[model samples]
Each structure stands twice: as structure tokens, then as C-alpha cells.
Target: MRVGRGAREDRADARDIEWPPSARSPGPAGRAGAARALAAAGASRHRARDFAWPGAHGAEAGVSGCGRRNILLVIFDSLGEGALASMADALPVLSGLRREALRFAAAYAPSPEGGPARASLFTGLDIPVHGVWTDGVALPERETTVAQRLAACGWRTWLVGRRHLAGVSNWTTEHARPFEYAHLDWAHGPLHRSRQNAYLAWLQDRAPAAYAEIFPTQANADDTDCPDWQRAAMSALPDALSFNRWVGARSCELLASHGRDGPFFGIAGFVIGETMGAAPRQSSPCEALQERALRQADAALGDILRQLERSGLAETTALVVTAARGSVAEADTDAPMQESAIRVPLMIRSPGLAAGTVAQAVSTIDVAATLYALSRVPPPRRLQGAPLLATGPGSVGRGWALSRLRRDHGWKTALRHGRWKLVVSHGDPDAGVQPGFSLFDLREDPEESRDLAADQAHQGMLETMIDLMIDARVAMEDRTEPRIASF
Candidate 1:
């Protein structure tokens, strides 16, 4: 069936189109796996020695548990913490997954949107540390992404999604990145159908006739990957041919290819419920559409898990399912630095960790560090976030979770210290307190309607927040000596 009008465009120029529309390539080369090599030398057991969670300043969380397990990371664009709410009737499958997984109740994105947030995850460092304070700007090549580090450790790294990994700035590839996989030919970004063309092309070549007929419209289709060419959000697609379904299909392919013995790292990025939180206009009617996306994504997830089980790799793979933020969803604005966004969902289903909810406040930056530890690779000294699942009993979350947003050349940073959160934007560059700030008691007002910054009662907390932000920035910038990371 004809779903909607095909966006009018010249096919001749389609392949050349990049995300960010005009994004330029920067120096593109990962550091020579120095940190990972070091980690490999020193790392012994797959599990942690004790409960060594990182402190306010991204200290050593000791080392994570488990080793050489395949990594399966599924990032659902902007689906935030709101999915855990009772009103999230659309996320039945995800809710079920969370029930069985080791959950992080207060996970954060570290940035207001996908570009910077993902940069944080790939690098294991915050905005100030990585210098990827915003989208559109490519993370400098000098920084080693997690994928690079993992690949260096004999792990087959496969990136299966769209979004900036390298620096394509076309409308569709806004989150797209440079083709950085060590050994994959189809590892480039597509205009639609999202990132994983390598897998889709493999499917097409494996059974061209069947693929051509998977959807009814393909009978007369010209582009072959019609759903992809249409640029429709994954939420807007039919279940049989949805982007989420493709995620499952691609993940299954990757799992099948790797088998049970090999080590691998895979990232499946899908536009689903999460995008609604940070930028509603990127999606609309968040509840209904996100519900559908969640179902499709869950279906893909189920397909993946089944593949893992069949391959006997389920227990060997360390799976991470999280979104960029919890929910930037507000009535008026969609900003990820808000409490909901800063408190997105984080679940870890790994061989070393048991099922439980981590009440600690972790940020997206920690993912790379966790992955490195899980792979038994040495994380870079410059990495800021600490590993989670590795800690023993009685371990608390970091003293704070960090978030930042770039309004222009300058930026503002948010600090979430326990129940209180302070957002400080660019003040006088010298003073850095041009009065652009807000503070809230998240325990009481998770929605952040109440500003406790000016209150006498929270004055001490406010000072603590300010000190945390100031000290962290200074530390981050001062140590810009090329920390290794991935995006």
C-alpha cells in the first residue's frame, strides 16, 4: 500500500547526502588502542574485587565484572525514564525486559540531545572532557571511541544504526557518524531505514526475491529499500517492515555471524519512543506513536534474544538497553538536561551481574567505561565515568550525574547530586555566573517545577552543586590530553 508521498528529491544526489546537511570531516583516526591494550594486560578476572563505585569525580570503580562477552547495545533514540511510569501502556515488552534485567533507576544522558549524549557514551567522558558539547560538531578523531578499543582487543565491532558516528550531517543521518568499523563493508549510514545497510544488503543478496516481496509495495519499488528511502520515522512504519524490526533482523544476523566463540560489540540505534522526550517535534503525540515504536523495538529485541539463545550466546553477551535520556518531555519545551532526561532508563543483563535496580545516578558517559571493563580492556586514564555492574553490595551510585547543553559557542552544565540538581549556563566567561542558572530538589519535584536555587534552606546544597560543576569542568578541561573513547 502507498503509505505517503515519496519525498521529492533527485536520486542522483541521494547517495552523497550526509547528516547535519553540511557536516565536514575532521581528523579521523582512533588512538592506537593504548588504554585498551593496557587494560588487557592488567585485567585478570571478569568480576570486580569489591564495591568500588566511582565518587563525584569519575574515580576508579575498580573494574567491572565479566570478560570477553559480546556486547549488544540498543539505543532507543530519546525514549526516557517516563517509559517506566504506569502511564506507559505502550511499552509492555520493554517493561518486561526491565523486570528481568539489572536496572539503573537514575541513569542520565549527559547532554540535551543525541549528538552530544552519544558522544559521551562512545567516549566514556563528559561534555567538557570529550569536547563534543553539541550535535553537528564531530568528535575529534584523536579521541578513541569504545568501538575502536573493543575492536583492537580482537572483538568484532559492528555498528548497526543511524546517527553521527563519523560526521555525516544530512537530515536523515543527523546522528550518523564516520564509518569506523574495523572490518565491515556495509558499515555506512543510510538516508532512512536507519543505520545497518550492511546487514540489509546482506539480506537482499541472500534472498533477493524474498526481500523484494517482504512488503507488498516492493513489487513496483525502484529503490528496493523503500522504507529506508522514504525517511519515515521508525515509529511511523508498519510492524513487518519497521526500522525496529530491522534492528532485530540485523542483530540476529550479527549474532549468527559471530557464533558462540567470538567476541563482538554491536550498537543498534533506532528512532522510537525516546526521540519524543528530547524533541517532540522530531516526533509527535508521544504516547501513541512511542507505544507503537516500543512494540516494534521490543519485537526486534525478542528476535535478538532468541537468536542469542539459539546460538548459546545469550549468557556470553553483555546486553545494554538504554536511551539517550529519560524524558525531555515538557508541555512547552523538549530539553534532555531536564530531570526526566537526566534520569533515563539503564538496564544491564550480563553474565556477571544479577538482576536488580541500581539506585545510583549514572550518566551515558559511563557506558564506554563499563564496556571496556566488561571486555577486560584497560579504559583510558582520561575516562571520567565509572563502571556500574562491577561493584559489590552496599555500593552507592556516583555522588553526582552530569549534564550539559550548548546554547552557542559557550554552554551550561547541570549537576545532579542526590535529590538536588543545579543547571548553570554560560555566565561571564571569567566569572561564569552571569546569573544563568536554576536549581531544583528532584526528590520532591522530579518535573522541576519548583526552583530551590534561591531558597535559604537549600543554600548549602546549591553551593555544593556549584562547586561540583566548577571543579568538574576545571578537571575535565585541564586533563585534555587525548583520552580514548568511541561514538
Candidate 2:
């Protein structure tokens, strides 16, 4: 194994990482209340336990007899497809590793936002079944998440990063605090959104010095790098710099501490794009913030990789790095099904995967299903995502991927079947929708500038694609009824 300091370690010294000061110190009452709730739920003691050992508990133990393959799921919140591709030059570590990675050229998010996107990822089901199509919608407790299933099957599942996963809505159900190691129950900064308590708590548990340096104090809305167009107010907490750094270091610490005996599942989820707003305008100031954050994230990723190598876990670990949703939004465009909103980057690198070659039209929801299949774990009954690995390259015979949007003013749907993509808005479909259905032959117009839906020649193709999309939605909504797997 190559042993050396990773990019994350080097960057730690690059900033004046400090805790932001909180005007009103969090009183003992709040801490006491939190402690009482956690104690009642056994969460306090659970969070205190060690998690480094791979497949430490549950069904994962039985599946990974030798702990042969570890799954490292890395998510960059609200990342842009074009931006990640452009960073090949600035981020040498990722660039160097890209050749060994499986790039999904036309990968997409199941939904336009984080909660829905992540819900699809964790449940291995699309939004229709998971029903978490928006930020606040709670994932029903009765539904089983891929994390829960994997844990049940013997993989030590750990979720670390951002509060979206275990937010108030999802937290109230069994899916809430579902992971064995979760950084839960924290608030925004006191003054500006610069200070993040959750990030601090996580750091304190793993790398205390790094935490102290990054978050010197708490913050509030003004401290955040939130874009001016943001519909919601920013919270006071750790500044962006401190929050990101703390998240990176703590995640690495957790990875470093894993046991080497069995297969493990680790999700390093970061709220990259969503931190500022739902979708920042192209010319928004947050563009600079996104750019810098991506670079910082790239550095952090390098560090995590180095840690894995140092721990001698890289060889066996299956590393899958991707984004939750796109951060780019067109001006005057609230349609979530638009390419800029629904499309995201997907990259996977595993021991047995086809190295360096890009995969065709995969979706984020496929990750959980693929992992379940690889780990010999039975997925939840409601899961709609299938195994990407089994699909293989150029085998997306279905020709197109489906996307649905049902939140905010963004109500639309799309079908990406091969190079021909059709986007249709659900609102006012019959009132002679002019741009309601846009057809783009991606091979020729990858940017999706012109609308070819009016063309008579492609009408048949568009109709067929629409049928496929509707069928998919129907099939997904009927998940309570079991269907046989083609594979």
C-alpha cells in the first residue's frame, strides 16, 4: 500500500480553522433535554460506541465472512456535472484516479432536490415508492432503507455528513437514526450560517484538534455563503470553511477506525449544492462558492483515499463517489425535470469493475440496489432501483432513464432513452403546451438548447418515450405488488 500524507491532511494547515463564538452559549437545559431524549432512545450510548470495525454487528457480519469488499459511498451535495468534469485539471488526485473510475456520462438524479434524491439512494426505490419527493417529506418508517437492509444482512452501515439524512421529518420514524453511527441533533450557527454544531460534534468525537481549529466558534445566517437569491434564511453556525473541513476530517477518522474483519458500508454525504439554495443561478455569487467548495471537496476526497490506502483497506474497498443533485438552475426556470436540474455526475470504482470506461445512463438509486446484490443482501420490498453493475456497459437496452419532479413550482417529467431525451411538464399538458415536450438528440445537441418536440419526424419517438416514462411511473407506484427481477 502507498503510505503518505493525504490531501486532506495537507489542507488542514491551509486555513485558520477555528470554532466561531456563539453569542448565547447553549445552556445546560438544552443539552440536558437532548441527553434525556437520546438516553431514552439509547442514542447517546449508541453514538459513543466505536465504529471502525467493519461489519461490527447485524447481518453484514454474516455476509462478509472475510470482509473482502468495503463500500465507500461518497456524495457531493448539489454538485454540477460540468463543474466536476472541468475540475480534472485543478484536482490532480481525482484526475489521476479517473482513469480507474467508471464515469456515467448520462447519470441522473431521481429527483431535483436532496431529500428526494437521497431517499431514492438509501431506499433503492424511486420517489414514487419512497414518497420522499421533497425536502421535508418524511420517509415512512415502515419502508426499509438500503442502509437498514445492509445492516440487517451484516454490513456495518455508517452515515456521516449533512443533516438532510436524519432531519426532523425522517428522524421521527424507524428510518430516523437508522445508521449505527450518525451525527445527529444539531442546529445552524448562532450569528451567521458559518458555524455548524453537528460538524463540531462529529469532529469532537473523532479529531478534536481539527474540530477546534475549524469551528473556533458558532455562527448564524450572515456567516453562511448562502446565495442572495436563497428563498430561505441562512442559519448561524460554523462558517463554510470550518464546517466543510470538520466534516472532512471527522469522516476520515471514522474510516480510519473501521475494523478490517468484514465488509463495510460507509456513506460520506455532504450538502454541497444545497448549502446555499435549492439551485443557484448561473451568474450567482454562490457560483464562486460552489467552485471553491468543489476544490476543497476534491482535496478532502484525496485525503480519504489516502487514509484508506494507509489502513490497507483500499484494495478491497469498493469506492463509489457521486453527487446528490445538480446545483445549477436556469433563470426563470423552475422546472425540476430540466437537464440542468435533474442531471448529476456518477462515478464508481471497484475491484471487479471495468476501469476507466464510462457507464451508460445510470441513476443514483442504482447504487443501493447494486450494493445489495454485491453483498448478497435482500433488498427492501419496495425498492425500485436495480443493480448497475449487472446492467453492464452499453446494456441500458431500455434506452432511456426516467426522472420525475413533484415539488415546488417544478412539476415535470423526462425520459432519456439513448441520445434522444424528451422533457414534458406535468402542468398544463393539454393546453397546447408549446415547450412542454422538448426532444433533444444528445449526440448532436448535448447542451439541450433547441426544442425538437414540434418536429413531425421525431413525434413517433417522443410518443414511444412518453409511454415508457408513464409505464415506469406506474410500475414504481405499484411497488407494493412484487415483480420478478429480469436478471
Candidate 3:
């Protein structure tokens, strides 16, 4: 790995890097709160509004959008619109954040599976090009990740939770550099507690008492045979002390302690839908509990946000909260193009961006690009996404979203171009799915209940969308080709 600014681990860990400011001042709010607190306290003389970033009055403010030095990217593992809508009553903190942030109404995941979806989010590339198709696969070394790019731009980056983008097999790869990699399997639900190794270590560092009370038993447990995939209800530990509360609390601590050398970029992933399945599935008591998991996630988010405000970094940190993908069926495996996986909630709250809603079509691929753009860091030229907050002249973005799914039952390619959507299936007739064409007018049938493939009146519309899908596929193939053939 290339040597970066601070002291770094030869093994690619940011935590191993020490900050001089943190060593000098140990603030009470967090373990290393002095670093950021020094900056915040020293910069308090400049009176600025929420959108007016200090020392960035004209061109810098216009280009970078704000003077925010820290980025907090929060991901809820498996939360869909339906689940969020059901728990609206329980998510007051998130609801308040939604009102304070810029909400994307049509943000979609690049893939349905968590690993592949995270690959897209990190690389800003689709599944076919990135070559990370599912949970155990790593993003190819040839592709540079967002973390590497941000580090090159002088950001102190740390990943505090689930890192599905890097496969265990590719840990030796040099692409994911200048960022600490910490992975955690949530303590409840269908997740194997054995996979919560990273979290246990973090708990020992941050909350020794909680770790002492909930170890060995968890270490010796056989949670691998989870049948329902839902987490067991959390124990009596207060929300701040619970095992499920670690990532959020840890992120809060980081937000308070970061930016001694420069701005920090941290991602924290939470377990939300431990067992909620895809659409047309029956809802039971267990499913309700799964929804409660979202509430817990929201509470965790609140904890982080409250800390942000308390640390006086509230106006300067760009916060984004989203998900990898959500399941619609009882099982975790599902077609990527399904609405349950595609429809996700994305909210960005930063200093310059106004609190409003964007109704245009957008993809999770846009996430990395947007973050880089907001930080005023130049992204790699080949990344395949538009900045979600692109403004001024020539700020238009990709008006379509493409996804693919190769499942045990069948495989299909889909694209949402404008108001039309096309799903081209390759097999699975036994599962009531066939190799044929299915079209939907998303404006009239957002749920895709009506298939317009056979409607001759819209034959031309169907043809154009099919061609659009084909052209998109060709573009992906061009990017992914080993021989470098034109699409």
C-alpha cells in the first residue's frame, strides 16, 4: 500500500494511525473528541448560516457546495420503502432528519444482493462491470474503490461496520487502501453471531462492560442455523449499551474525534431487516419485530446525529443515510430488479444543500460520485454515475437505471428508462416465470401490476425501451470486456 499522511498500518487500517491533536486533548464527549473539537472551537468566530460555510464565501462554496470537512455515510442493511413507511410512527428522529435533508424519491440500488449492491455503491459501477455479483465476491482489483480515491484526495477514511464490498478472499488486494476495514454481523436475527467478530473487538475497545456481559456465550453459540432470519429481541441493556448499538455509538465517537490531519470520511452500516422478505409474502408477528429493528436503527442514527450537533460539527458534516438493498420474499435471495430491492430511501443533509425532495430517477451508483463531488475531490474519470446534487449549467444526470439478477430459478435483465420499465426474463417457468418480455408504464403502474408487453397501442414505446436496455447492456459489456471491444 502507498504510504499516506498519518502513521498507517502496513495492513491498511486507519485506526493504527495516530493524531497529534487527539493525543494532546482527550475531550469527554468521545475517546478522541479533541481533534475535531479543536477545529470547531477555533472556527466558531465566523458567523455562518446553515448553508454558508466558513472561509468558503464565493467560488469554493459554489464548486464544493459547502465547507463540510466530514462525511458520515450510514447504511441500514435491509430497509425498503414499505418497511420504513410502516415504522413511520417509530422513526421520529429519522423523520426530523428527512425534513432537514435532501431526500431522493427515486434512488435505486444497482443490484439486489447486499454484496453486489455495496460493490456498486463503493465503485459507482454496475454489477456486470465491477464483477462482484454476490455476497462472497470481491470487487476486482483493477477497479479503484471510492475509499482509495478519497484517500488520494487527503481524507482520513474509516469503515466502522459491515464491509460487504471486500470479499475475505481479496483482503490481500491493494485497491482498498487508506481506510480501516471493520465488518460486523448484527447480534440478532438470522445473522451468524460468529461473524460478529469485528464488532466484539470494537465493543471491547469502546464498551468493555457490555462486551464482558455478552461474550463467550455468544462466542460458543451455534447461531448459524437461523430458520426465520429475524434477530432475537434485544436484551435489557439500554439502547446506548446494547450490542446492536455499537456501530452507531462508535460512529458518533468517530465523528466527534475525527479531522486532526484533515476531513474524515466514515461509513457505518446497521442491521435493519434481519428477516423481512420480499413482496406478496405473508406478514406475521415476527415480521413486526423485524420492523422494530428499523426503529432501533433509527434510534442509532439519532444517537450519531445528536453527537454531531453536540460536537459543534453539525453544520460542517455531510451526512448520508441509505441501505444496501432490501428483501421482498421470505428468503434473502431475490431477483435484483424486483421493486422490493430497487426502491430504497436516500437522504443527504449537508451545509449547502437545501432541504427538499428530488423526484428524478437516480441510482445508488450516484452516491459515491455525489460524495466525492461534495467534498470537492475529483473522482476517477471512468466511474459510471452522475452527482446526485449536480446543479448549475449541464448538471443533468442519467435518466435511467439498470439492474441484473441471475437467481437459482432464473435470470433477467431490467432497465428503467423514463416512464417505461422492461424486464427480460431468461427462464424459471416452473416458478411462474418464463423467458419472455414484461413491460410496465411506471407512471401508471409503479407496482408493475400491469404488463404492457402485448399492448400494440404502445408497441413503439416498448421497442424503444427494449432497445434502451440492449444499448445499456452493450455499454456494460464494453466497460467489463477483457479484450476492450466496443459495445
Candidate 4:
């Protein structure tokens, strides 16, 4: 149960804290509603009995006069569930939380990469509703974020770390103004500037030999074997140290100062995985180095936790550890869309959450709903994800998650429903790489080595799954038609 020694102290002193932007006060009626919502969500009455852990050091329901509960969401980029299991030796902090936190065995991302997945989380809408199909796609100004909704309800909301919203360029003053304390790495530069420059420098210095060793041929010259190639590629851009440190310190400060008065919303995101095809330490073949990067990221999370506990905000804080997306797995093969790229480790610990494991197929889109449900804020009606709090392990793994790739000719869409998945290459499958359907018994064939689409018995089932997937994609396209002007 004791995950780390003196890890608590290491957290409090890690960095300086920053408070969130204060908004107009909520009227008495709104406050009452918030209270009711919180109580209904079980935030106000989290007795030791609330936890499924029998021997846990239980505490009485503690709602500080501060008004609202605090949320510290830590999302690591490209950290997959398989990677967590593979690197279990290095990631003790995360593995340890399996006992106390609710683990969703089949957590999924609606999109394949950062932009669309994060867009889904923030807007509570599917890709089509938000119109943010990929990275750099702008979020329509009219759509609301979970943070924006909470802020409007009188909660001080500050967003720290990488800002990967699809449509940030057309930001408006009223709905999409800068977060109270916005921390982002625009590209790559200085500690507070570019992430690319640091990455390039790391590549040149830390593991220059690996860089030289991997980029021997032009076909793969652009593709380096070093695991941290993204980091090295990002060296040509900006630095995110101050932003990372600032966000961490500020989260603790905000939790301590605002936790007693009312609830606050804080989001701390990190791009721990490689951004480009190269980076020095991240590119090392040594599994120890790769794991160390992940563990350091975990340690950073521990720091944030220590701050909350130090300020007596631990029990009242809702801490969610997740990822925007997962890293590539099976580097030995050509497969990139397996469980590694889409499946992530999800750990949700809140006063309102019942401690246990949830084996249902959930997506990133559900995150906003969970936050709003816990904070007493109403989720935007347009959200596509369902509320997952307090839900028991589901028997139906019937829901499918969608992923898309923007190709030169057209867009490629993928639909994964439980054990069967279908990939449709819309633009030019006739040119050679046409759309394909892959079916596997995930429980029996976790590696996806066997393709069952050719099986006669599974033909009907595959067709049914493919039809459903195509229908979902069509629905998404139709939903975004009206939001074209918002951005």
C-alpha cells in the first residue's frame, strides 16, 4: 500500500504553485444547485464506506467551506496500457494505484492521435459534433469545454500544460479566451518557448550515437528507431520546462487555497512521449531509460498529489490519470492501430467514485461528463459520451470507438467494437490500399495476429460491425455541418 517513501515531501517542494483565474461569483441559487448536485453525485458524503477497500484508512465526509471540490487531471501523451504493463518494473507509482483507484480495463480513445481525442474530452462531443477531426483543427467558438462550463458556474478554472484544442487560432474573447493560467508548448523552442529546439539538442547531445545509428538509410531516415524520436524531432521547436513546472506548482497552490472556499477545476497535461522521430535519452534502446522517462512523469504526478494532501485537499480532490492517446506498439510489425495506440491506463479517484474496477468499454469522450457529474455542473447536452461514475462493470462490450486518419486522397476511418474491428479506407482502396476489416477474439488473440474476417462464421458478424461503423461515421459528418461558423 505504501507506494513510495517520502514521495509526499518530494511533491510539495517540486515547484511553485499558481492560482486559477477568478470568475464572477455564482448567486445563492446556483450555489444551492451545485451543493445538491455534489451531494447527489456523492461528493459531499464520501465516508470510508464509500470505498470498496475494507481496510482503507477511512475518513468522514469532508466538504471544506471552500465551496466546490478540486479536480487535478493529469494526462500523459502516448502512454498505453500495454506499455504500463510492460514497463511495470519502472512505473511502480501507477501500478500501485490499481488497488485504490477505479481501473477501466477497456478504456478507449475516440480518435487515434492528440488533437481529436483531446477535442472529444473537452467538448464532450464526438469528432463530428465538434468539427475537430484532427490536430490543428479548431474547436468551434460556440462549443463549451468542461472548464468553461465550470467557470461560468463560478468555479475558478485554469488549464495548464499542452493546449491541443483543434481550433485555437480563431479563439474568441467570450467563449474561448485564454485560460486564467494557460500553459502550453506552441511548438518547440526555449524552456518557456519551443519544444523542438530542446528535442533537437537532446538528439545531438544525449544520444548522438543512437541518432547516428538509427538514421542510416533514407527510407527510414525520416523514421528513427530510437523510442523517443518524437522528442528528438521536437527539439527543433520549443521548451516546456517552465510550463510543466509552473502548472504542477500552481495546481497544488490552487488546491490548497481554493479547496476550502469552493470547488476549482485544474487540468495538468504533459507530452512525455516522443514528439518527433528522435530525442536523446528517449531514443535509447535501454528499456531502463524509456521506463525512467515514464517513471519521472509518474513522480511528477506524485508531487501534485503531495501538494493536495499537504493542504488537506487530498480526500476532497478528484484526481484522474489518463492519456490523450497511447504510444505505438509492436514496433517489430506494421500494425499501429492495435491496443497500444488507442488503449490507455485510466485511474479515477474521487470522493464520489466507488472504488473498484470497471471493465466496460469507455471512451475519452466520457471524461467531461464524469467531471461535470462530480462537480455538480450540468454536462453540455451535445456530448456523445455517457456518464460512467458509479456504473458497475458492464456486460455489453457492444459499443464501438472510432478513429480516423487524414490521408492525401481522403480520410480513413476505423471502428473498433469489442473484439471485432473494421478499417475503411474511403479515398482509394482500389489503388491498392483499400479498406479492410479485421476481426479477432481480443481475449484469445490479444496481439491481433489472426485475422478472422475471412472466416465464414464471422462473415455476418463482421458485416454487421462494418455497417454499424460506417453509420457512426456518417452521423458524425452530419452533426458537424451546423457548427462551421462557430470557430
Tens-digit lDDT track for model 2 on 356-474? 55435667777777776556554544555666665566442222467776623436777765556777775544554433566677767877777766765555445444554555455
**What is candidate 1's lDDT per residue for 403-441, written digit by digit as tens?**
776654235677765566778756555645364568776
Cα displacement (Å) at residue 312, model 3:
1.6
Which has the better lDDT: candidate 1, or candidate 3?
3
Error of 1 at 247 (Å): 1.1
lDDT of 4: 0.54
* Candidate 3 residue-wise lDDT, 106-167, digit = tens: 67777666667888888877787788875567677778777676665566777655565654
**CA lDDT, candidate 1, residue 308:** 87
Q: Which ten contiguous residues of candidate 3 have the minimum total lDDT?
A: 278-287
> What is the C-alpha RMSD, rounded to one decimal, of candidate 3?
17.7
For model 4 the local lDDT of residue 2 reads 11
The predicted structure with the larger lDDT, 1 or 2, is: 1
RMSD of every candidate to native, in Å, equals 15.7, 18.5, 17.7, 16.4
Residue 184, candidate 1: C-alpha displacement in angstroms: 5.2
Off by over 4 Å in 2: 1-68, 166-175, 178-196, 200-241, 274-289, 329-335, 394-397, 428-435, 480-487
By lDDT rank, best first, the candidates go: 3, 1, 2, 4
Model 4: how far residue 330 lies from native, Å: 6.7
**In model 4, which range of ten residues has the least summed lDDT?**
14-23
Cα-based lDDT for every prediction: 0.57, 0.56, 0.59, 0.54
